[model samples]
Target: MATASETKATRRDFLYVATGAVGAVGVAGVAWPLIDQLNPDASVLALASIRFDIAPIVEGSSVTILWRGLPVFIRHRTEAEIEEARAVPMADLKDPQRDEDRVVEGHDQWLIMIANCTHLGCVPVGEAGDFDGWFCPCHGSHYDTSGRIRRGPAPANLVVPPYEFISDTVVQIG
Candidate 1:
Protein backbone atom coordinates (compact mmCIF):
# COMPACT_ATOMS: atom_id res chain seq x y z
CA MET A 1 0.00 0.00 0.00
CA ALA A 2 1.25 3.55 -0.79
CA THR A 3 1.64 6.13 1.98
CA ALA A 4 -0.50 9.35 1.90
CA SER A 5 2.56 11.49 1.01
CA GLU A 6 3.37 9.20 -1.99
CA THR A 7 -0.21 9.40 -3.29
CA LYS A 8 -0.15 13.20 -2.90
CA ALA A 9 3.10 13.38 -4.89
CA THR A 10 1.61 11.31 -7.76
CA ARG A 11 -1.43 13.58 -7.91
CA ARG A 12 0.83 16.68 -7.93
CA ASP A 13 2.90 15.23 -10.81
CA PHE A 14 -0.23 14.44 -12.86
CA LEU A 15 -1.49 18.02 -12.32
CA TYR A 16 1.82 19.46 -13.60
CA VAL A 17 1.74 17.20 -16.72
CA ALA A 18 -1.89 18.13 -17.49
CA THR A 19 -1.20 21.81 -16.99
CA GLY A 20 1.84 21.69 -19.29
CA ALA A 21 -0.12 19.94 -22.06
CA VAL A 22 -2.96 22.50 -21.86
CA GLY A 23 -0.43 25.36 -21.92
CA ALA A 24 1.22 23.93 -25.02
CA VAL A 25 -2.16 23.67 -26.77
CA GLY A 26 -3.00 27.26 -25.83
CA VAL A 27 0.33 28.51 -27.16
CA ALA A 28 -0.18 26.63 -30.43
CA GLY A 29 -3.67 28.04 -30.81
CA VAL A 30 -2.41 31.59 -30.37
CA ALA A 31 0.76 31.13 -32.44
CA TRP A 32 -0.94 29.55 -35.46
CA PRO A 33 -2.85 32.66 -36.49
CA LEU A 34 0.14 34.90 -35.77
CA ILE A 35 2.43 32.74 -37.88
CA ASP A 36 -0.10 32.37 -40.69
CA GLN A 37 -0.65 36.14 -40.77
CA LEU A 38 2.98 36.69 -41.71
CA ASN A 39 2.54 34.76 -44.96
CA PRO A 40 1.08 36.48 -48.05
CA ASP A 41 -2.44 35.58 -49.11
CA ALA A 42 -3.00 33.22 -52.06
CA SER A 43 -4.23 35.93 -54.42
CA VAL A 44 -1.38 38.31 -53.52
CA LEU A 45 1.22 35.60 -54.12
CA ALA A 46 -0.35 34.88 -57.53
CA LEU A 47 0.13 38.49 -58.69
CA ALA A 48 3.51 37.75 -60.24
CA SER A 49 4.78 39.15 -63.52
CA ILE A 50 3.13 38.07 -66.77
CA ARG A 51 4.31 37.85 -70.39
CA PHE A 52 2.70 38.47 -73.81
CA ASP A 53 3.51 37.77 -77.43
CA ILE A 54 3.45 40.90 -79.63
CA ALA A 55 3.25 39.11 -82.97
CA PRO A 56 -0.55 38.99 -83.07
CA ILE A 57 -1.15 42.69 -82.32
CA VAL A 58 -1.35 44.60 -85.60
CA GLU A 59 -0.36 48.21 -86.20
CA GLY A 60 -3.01 50.85 -85.37
CA SER A 61 -4.78 48.25 -83.21
CA SER A 62 -4.86 47.75 -79.44
CA VAL A 63 -5.40 44.82 -77.13
CA THR A 64 -6.27 44.80 -73.45
CA ILE A 65 -4.68 42.16 -71.25
CA LEU A 66 -5.19 41.51 -67.55
CA TRP A 67 -2.22 41.96 -65.25
CA ARG A 68 -2.50 41.90 -61.50
CA GLY A 69 -6.30 42.29 -61.90
CA LEU A 70 -5.82 45.51 -63.91
CA PRO A 71 -6.24 46.17 -67.65
CA VAL A 72 -3.01 46.73 -69.59
CA PHE A 73 -3.22 48.24 -73.05
CA ILE A 74 -0.80 47.04 -75.68
CA ARG A 75 -0.93 49.13 -78.79
CA HIS A 76 0.82 48.59 -82.08
CA ARG A 77 0.96 52.20 -83.15
CA THR A 78 0.94 53.22 -86.78
CA GLU A 79 3.54 55.54 -88.31
CA ALA A 80 1.05 58.37 -88.24
CA GLU A 81 0.24 57.73 -84.59
CA ILE A 82 3.92 57.61 -83.72
CA GLU A 83 4.56 60.90 -85.51
CA GLU A 84 1.64 62.60 -83.82
CA ALA A 85 2.82 61.52 -80.39
CA ARG A 86 6.41 62.56 -81.08
CA ALA A 87 5.49 65.95 -82.52
CA VAL A 88 3.71 67.17 -79.41
CA PRO A 89 5.63 69.78 -77.37
CA MET A 90 5.89 69.26 -73.60
CA ALA A 91 4.14 72.63 -73.05
CA ASP A 92 0.97 71.32 -74.79
CA LEU A 93 0.54 68.33 -72.47
CA LYS A 94 -1.24 68.27 -69.12
CA ASP A 95 1.10 65.49 -67.99
CA PRO A 96 4.22 66.32 -69.95
CA GLN A 97 6.06 63.11 -70.83
CA ARG A 98 8.02 62.75 -74.07
CA ASP A 99 6.68 60.21 -76.56
CA GLU A 100 10.16 58.77 -76.95
CA ASP A 101 10.45 58.39 -73.17
CA ARG A 102 7.28 56.29 -73.09
CA VAL A 103 8.37 53.71 -75.69
CA VAL A 104 11.14 51.17 -75.88
CA GLU A 105 14.34 52.50 -77.51
CA GLY A 106 14.30 50.50 -80.75
CA HIS A 107 10.64 49.40 -80.70
CA ASP A 108 8.79 52.69 -81.11
CA GLN A 109 5.82 50.96 -82.72
CA TRP A 110 4.81 49.22 -79.48
CA LEU A 111 3.07 51.40 -76.86
CA ILE A 112 2.36 49.53 -73.64
CA MET A 113 0.61 51.16 -70.68
CA ILE A 114 -1.97 50.44 -68.02
CA ALA A 115 -5.53 51.17 -69.19
CA ASN A 116 -6.90 52.64 -65.97
CA CYS A 117 -7.58 56.37 -66.08
CA THR A 118 -5.51 58.35 -63.60
CA HIS A 119 -8.54 60.45 -62.56
CA LEU A 120 -10.80 57.85 -61.01
CA GLY A 121 -9.58 54.39 -62.03
CA CYS A 122 -11.95 53.99 -64.98
CA VAL A 123 -10.91 51.86 -67.96
CA PRO A 124 -10.47 54.00 -71.08
CA VAL A 125 -11.73 53.04 -74.54
CA GLY A 126 -9.01 52.62 -77.16
CA GLU A 127 -8.62 54.87 -80.21
CA ALA A 128 -11.61 56.96 -79.18
CA GLY A 129 -10.06 60.16 -77.85
CA ASP A 130 -9.34 63.39 -79.77
CA PHE A 131 -5.66 62.42 -79.82
CA ASP A 132 -6.49 58.94 -81.20
CA GLY A 133 -5.35 57.29 -78.01
CA TRP A 134 -7.56 56.35 -75.06
CA PHE A 135 -10.71 58.08 -73.85
CA CYS A 136 -12.17 57.63 -70.41
CA PRO A 137 -15.84 58.37 -71.00
CA CYS A 138 -16.61 58.03 -67.33
CA HIS A 139 -14.84 61.34 -66.60
CA GLY A 140 -13.77 62.74 -69.98
CA SER A 141 -10.06 62.12 -69.44
CA HIS A 142 -8.12 61.95 -72.70
CA TYR A 143 -4.72 60.34 -73.13
CA ASP A 144 -2.48 60.80 -76.14
CA THR A 145 -0.91 58.05 -78.23
CA SER A 146 1.99 57.95 -75.81
CA GLY A 147 -0.38 57.47 -72.82
CA ARG A 148 0.28 60.98 -71.56
CA ILE A 149 -2.78 62.74 -70.16
CA ARG A 150 -3.71 65.34 -72.79
CA ARG A 151 -6.98 66.67 -71.46
CA GLY A 152 -9.23 66.11 -68.47
CA PRO A 153 -9.40 65.91 -64.69
CA ALA A 154 -6.74 63.22 -64.51
CA PRO A 155 -3.74 64.48 -62.59
CA ALA A 156 -1.18 62.13 -64.12
CA ASN A 157 -0.43 60.12 -67.23
CA LEU A 158 -1.56 56.55 -67.77
CA VAL A 159 0.71 54.23 -65.80
CA VAL A 160 3.38 52.27 -67.66
CA PRO A 161 4.04 48.99 -65.89
CA PRO A 162 7.52 47.51 -65.73
CA TYR A 163 8.18 45.58 -68.92
CA GLU A 164 11.06 44.24 -70.95
CA PHE A 165 11.25 42.86 -74.46
CA ILE A 166 12.53 39.36 -73.76
CA SER A 167 12.78 38.75 -77.50
CA ASP A 168 12.08 40.79 -80.60
CA THR A 169 8.43 39.79 -80.44
CA VAL A 170 7.86 38.77 -76.82
CA VAL A 171 7.45 41.08 -73.81
CA GLN A 172 7.38 40.32 -70.11
CA ILE A 173 5.30 42.71 -67.92
CA GLY A 174 5.18 43.18 -64.21
Candidate 2:
Protein backbone atom coordinates (compact mmCIF):
# COMPACT_ATOMS: atom_id res chain seq x y z
CA MET A 1 0.00 0.00 0.00
CA ALA A 2 2.92 2.40 0.49
CA THR A 3 4.90 1.51 -2.66
CA ALA A 4 5.24 4.26 -5.34
CA SER A 5 4.44 1.88 -8.27
CA GLU A 6 1.28 0.61 -6.52
CA THR A 7 0.13 4.16 -5.82
CA LYS A 8 0.66 5.06 -9.50
CA ALA A 9 -1.40 2.03 -10.60
CA THR A 10 -4.23 2.96 -8.22
CA ARG A 11 -4.20 6.57 -9.55
CA ARG A 12 -4.27 5.31 -13.16
CA ASP A 13 -7.23 3.01 -12.39
CA PHE A 14 -9.13 5.92 -10.84
CA LEU A 15 -8.34 8.13 -13.85
CA TYR A 16 -9.63 5.44 -16.23
CA VAL A 17 -12.83 5.05 -14.24
CA ALA A 18 -13.33 8.83 -14.10
CA THR A 19 -12.73 9.22 -17.82
CA GLY A 20 -15.18 6.40 -18.61
CA ALA A 21 -17.84 8.01 -16.44
CA VAL A 22 -17.35 11.35 -18.20
CA GLY A 23 -17.52 9.69 -21.63
CA ALA A 24 -20.81 7.98 -20.66
CA VAL A 25 -22.17 11.34 -19.53
CA GLY A 26 -21.05 12.96 -22.76
CA VAL A 27 -22.68 10.23 -24.85
CA ALA A 28 -25.93 10.64 -22.95
CA GLY A 29 -25.80 14.41 -23.46
CA VAL A 30 -25.39 13.91 -27.20
CA ALA A 31 -28.18 11.32 -27.40
CA TRP A 32 -30.73 13.30 -25.38
CA PRO A 33 -31.55 15.88 -28.04
CA LEU A 34 -31.76 13.19 -30.68
CA ILE A 35 -34.31 11.25 -28.62
CA ASP A 36 -36.35 14.31 -27.66
CA GLN A 37 -36.56 15.50 -31.26
CA LEU A 38 -38.51 12.36 -32.18
CA ASN A 39 -41.48 13.53 -30.14
CA PRO A 40 -44.33 15.58 -31.61
CA ASP A 41 -43.58 19.07 -32.93
CA ALA A 42 -44.45 22.14 -30.87
CA SER A 43 -47.46 22.98 -33.04
CA VAL A 44 -48.83 19.47 -32.65
CA LEU A 45 -48.34 19.56 -28.90
CA ALA A 46 -50.13 22.92 -28.72
CA LEU A 47 -53.19 21.33 -30.39
CA ALA A 48 -53.24 18.54 -27.82
CA SER A 49 -54.97 20.82 -25.31
CA ILE A 50 -56.67 24.15 -25.67
CA ARG A 51 -58.41 26.64 -23.38
CA PHE A 52 -61.41 28.45 -24.85
CA ASP A 53 -63.56 31.33 -23.71
CA ILE A 54 -67.17 30.17 -23.71
CA ALA A 55 -68.76 33.36 -22.48
CA PRO A 56 -69.58 34.67 -25.93
CA ILE A 57 -71.98 31.79 -26.64
CA VAL A 58 -75.54 32.43 -25.47
CA GLU A 59 -78.16 29.97 -24.31
CA GLY A 60 -79.49 27.55 -26.97
CA SER A 61 -76.50 28.48 -29.12
CA SER A 62 -73.35 26.57 -29.92
CA VAL A 63 -70.00 26.94 -31.64
CA THR A 64 -67.71 24.56 -33.46
CA ILE A 65 -64.02 24.59 -32.80
CA LEU A 66 -61.28 22.47 -34.24
CA TRP A 67 -59.53 20.13 -31.81
CA ARG A 68 -56.84 17.71 -32.92
CA GLY A 69 -58.18 17.84 -36.51
CA LEU A 70 -61.79 17.18 -35.50
CA PRO A 71 -64.84 19.42 -35.18
CA VAL A 72 -65.81 19.84 -31.53
CA PHE A 73 -69.26 21.23 -30.77
CA ILE A 74 -69.67 23.30 -27.66
CA ARG A 75 -73.30 24.04 -26.86
CA HIS A 76 -74.70 26.43 -24.29
CA ARG A 77 -77.95 24.72 -23.46
CA THR A 78 -81.13 26.61 -22.64
CA GLU A 79 -83.13 25.67 -19.58
CA ALA A 80 -85.76 24.04 -21.77
CA GLU A 81 -83.14 21.98 -23.59
CA ILE A 82 -81.65 20.80 -20.34
CA GLU A 83 -85.08 19.88 -19.02
CA GLU A 84 -85.95 17.98 -22.17
CA ALA A 85 -82.69 16.12 -22.08
CA ARG A 86 -83.17 15.20 -18.43
CA ALA A 87 -86.72 14.02 -18.97
CA VAL A 88 -85.88 11.28 -21.42
CA PRO A 89 -86.15 7.75 -20.09
CA MET A 90 -83.09 5.54 -20.36
CA ALA A 91 -85.13 2.85 -22.14
CA ASP A 92 -85.96 5.23 -25.02
CA LEU A 93 -82.37 5.94 -25.98
CA LYS A 94 -80.47 4.18 -28.72
CA ASP A 95 -77.32 5.09 -26.86
CA PRO A 96 -78.32 5.28 -23.23
CA GLN A 97 -76.18 8.08 -21.78
CA ARG A 98 -77.89 10.26 -19.24
CA ASP A 99 -77.99 14.02 -19.74
CA GLU A 100 -76.49 14.37 -16.30
CA ASP A 101 -73.70 11.95 -17.18
CA ARG A 102 -72.83 13.62 -20.50
CA VAL A 103 -72.17 17.00 -18.93
CA VAL A 104 -69.99 18.16 -16.07
CA GLU A 105 -71.87 18.02 -12.76
CA GLY A 106 -72.18 21.72 -11.88
CA HIS A 107 -71.99 22.94 -15.47
CA ASP A 108 -74.92 21.01 -16.88
CA GLN A 109 -75.76 23.85 -19.24
CA TRP A 110 -72.65 23.20 -21.30
CA LEU A 111 -72.54 20.17 -23.61
CA ILE A 112 -69.38 19.42 -25.53
CA MET A 113 -69.10 16.61 -28.05
CA ILE A 114 -67.46 15.66 -31.27
CA ALA A 115 -69.68 16.88 -34.15
CA ASN A 116 -69.17 14.00 -36.57
CA CYS A 117 -71.96 11.49 -36.96
CA THR A 118 -71.21 8.11 -35.41
CA HIS A 119 -72.29 6.02 -38.42
CA LEU A 120 -70.46 8.16 -40.92
CA GLY A 121 -68.16 11.18 -40.59
CA CYS A 122 -70.79 13.76 -41.65
CA VAL A 123 -71.20 16.80 -39.45
CA PRO A 124 -74.67 17.00 -37.90
CA VAL A 125 -76.93 19.96 -38.34
CA GLY A 126 -77.43 21.54 -34.92
CA GLU A 127 -80.92 22.52 -33.68
CA ALA A 128 -82.45 20.62 -36.56
CA GLY A 129 -82.78 17.04 -35.35
CA ASP A 130 -86.03 15.23 -34.44
CA PHE A 131 -85.13 15.39 -30.75
CA ASP A 132 -83.81 18.96 -30.84
CA GLY A 133 -80.15 17.94 -30.64
CA TRP A 134 -78.33 17.40 -33.91
CA PHE A 135 -79.29 15.74 -37.16
CA CYS A 136 -77.00 13.97 -39.53
CA PRO A 137 -78.83 14.22 -42.84
CA CYS A 138 -76.32 11.98 -44.54
CA HIS A 139 -77.63 8.86 -42.80
CA GLY A 140 -80.72 10.10 -40.88
CA SER A 141 -79.05 9.85 -37.47
CA HIS A 142 -80.86 11.84 -34.79
CA TYR A 143 -79.16 12.82 -31.56
CA ASP A 144 -80.93 14.06 -28.46
CA THR A 145 -80.25 17.25 -26.54
CA SER A 146 -77.72 15.26 -24.55
CA GLY A 147 -76.05 14.15 -27.81
CA ARG A 148 -77.29 10.62 -27.29
CA ILE A 149 -78.12 8.67 -30.40
CA ARG A 150 -81.91 8.46 -30.60
CA ARG A 151 -82.76 7.23 -34.05
CA GLY A 152 -81.40 6.04 -37.41
CA PRO A 153 -77.96 4.89 -38.48
CA ALA A 154 -75.66 6.22 -35.76
CA PRO A 155 -74.64 3.34 -33.53
CA ALA A 156 -73.58 5.39 -30.56
CA ASN A 157 -73.71 8.82 -28.97
CA LEU A 158 -71.53 11.67 -30.11
CA VAL A 159 -68.13 11.36 -28.47
CA VAL A 160 -67.51 13.56 -25.45
CA PRO A 161 -63.99 14.97 -25.37
CA PRO A 162 -62.00 15.20 -22.16
CA TYR A 163 -62.65 18.66 -20.81
CA GLU A 164 -62.97 20.67 -17.66
CA PHE A 165 -64.19 24.09 -16.67
CA ILE A 166 -61.13 26.22 -16.02
CA SER A 167 -63.27 29.05 -14.70
CA ASP A 168 -66.95 30.06 -14.89
CA THR A 169 -66.47 31.04 -18.51
CA VAL A 170 -63.41 29.11 -19.65
CA VAL A 171 -63.08 25.45 -20.61
CA GLN A 172 -60.01 23.40 -21.31
CA ILE A 173 -60.51 20.60 -23.85
CA GLY A 174 -58.15 17.91 -24.97
TM-score per model over all chains: 0.77, 0.84
Per-residue lDDT tens digits of candidate 2, residues 1-174?
675553345788889999999999999999999999999998999999999999999988999999999999999999999999999999998888888888999999999999999997899999987999899999899998899999998899999999999999999998
State each model's CA lDDT, in order. 0.91, 0.94
lDDT of 1 by residue, 1-174 (tens): 976653445788989999999999999999999999999888877777888999998888989999999999999999999999999999999878898888889999999998899999999999888888889999999888889998899999999898999999899997
Local error of candidate 2 at residue 143 (angstroms): 0.5
Backbone clash pairs for candidate 1 read none
Candidate 1 whole-model C-alpha lDDT, 0 to 1: 0.91
lDDT of 1 at 91: 98
